[model samples]
Target: MTGEVAGGRVPLPQRTAEARLIVVARAKRAEDYDRVLDVLVEAGIRSIELTLTTPGTFERLPALTDRYGASVDLGVGTVTSEAELARAIGAGARYIVTPVTSAALVAQAREAAVPIVPGGLTPTELFASWSAGASAVKIFPAGQVGASYLKDLRGPFPDLVAVPSGGVDLDGAAAWLAAGAAAVSVGGPLLGDAFAGGDLAALGTRAEAFVSLCARTAH
Candidate 1:
């Protein structure tokens, strides 16, 4: 798939499925995004999701778009309300990601021509999001359910597109992809101390590691 929809905007599903790894970033401060994102982009990480839990997400999103629009797909994650969703889109987020399943947000994103991936744990919640026009459903806390859960999900909903998020380590990411996950959304394990006094050089190394690993499983 080209990943683009009616408005020429690349849908989230196509992008994530192709990239195979969505780096979930959290920073204590907003300005830290510049260096962190720079390291990730230079390391060949194509898709990055900045969370609302971080400060200055809405404020700095536009600048981030201008800074690294081509090399990386910049999106907002940890969204919970329609207002936050609206702000994210207005601030130049290419896509939206929620930590919970909200069909209202999914439907709104569909209407706006922006692909959204909403999180859910149960089959019912996931199916509701997917059916509601979600670009892809996020299988939250994927480590808890294990890769086999996705294999099971395919039994009832063969076409269910899932991005396994939350607690997915490097090996877990590979395992999930092997189990047929559309992509893997990874945070802490990949990022480590990059946000704090952690070594950015090592962060770049980890970023490259995950990117290389994910690329091996590309659809």
Candidate 2:
């Protein structure tokens, strides 16, 4: 089940399928990024994504990685360029996720040996991303598509590892899992500003709720 990537050998799919809880924090300041990551780690959200929206994202990413990379699956989202990809990798990004699929970026991630989860909407986009070597396809704004859509989608593309992103919540997580999603990525809707605003206890509570729901559905 283990596969080799550019960075190193990634564990088998079974091990990676811990019903991920990816917290994507958006901000225009490094302080915000710090707050979100700190809370996420404390709340036990081991996988975190720092979207490239903050002014000092590049500088902050490495610092965060240096501090937490050993225990966290730190990654970057909304990545668009080869330079940005390199920067994220240098900063110790364990994975690369994008809002849109790009052949060049996917290729670079492959070279770096990091799993790339590129964004795709329609069936065409999903398959295209898979064909381009994407490890998983993120269905951005998946709220509009709904869990039933995934159920129907997997019927045809059974091997596709779909990750529904944007607007996913605890109550709805099970539906997505039952629909056959490999994992789910939630943003503000799950890890609200309270968590991003320095509320560790609240974040931890929310993390537990999310994990509970995902675990329940996974079985």
**Candidate 2, 57-112: lDDT as tens digits:** 77788788787777677778889888888888777777888998787787777766
Clashes of 1: 0
Query: Can you write out model 1's per-residue Cα lDDT over 152-206, one digit (the tens) per residue?
Result: 9999999887899989988998999999888899999989988896898999999
Give the top-scoring candidate (TM-score).
Answer: 1
Model 2 residue 188 lDDT score: 72
How does each model score on TM-score?
0.94, 0.87
lDDT of 2 at 39: 62
Model 1 misplaced stretches (Cα beyond 4 Å) = 1-10, 13-15
Residue pairs of candidate 2 with colliding backbone atoms:
5-113, 6-113, 7-113
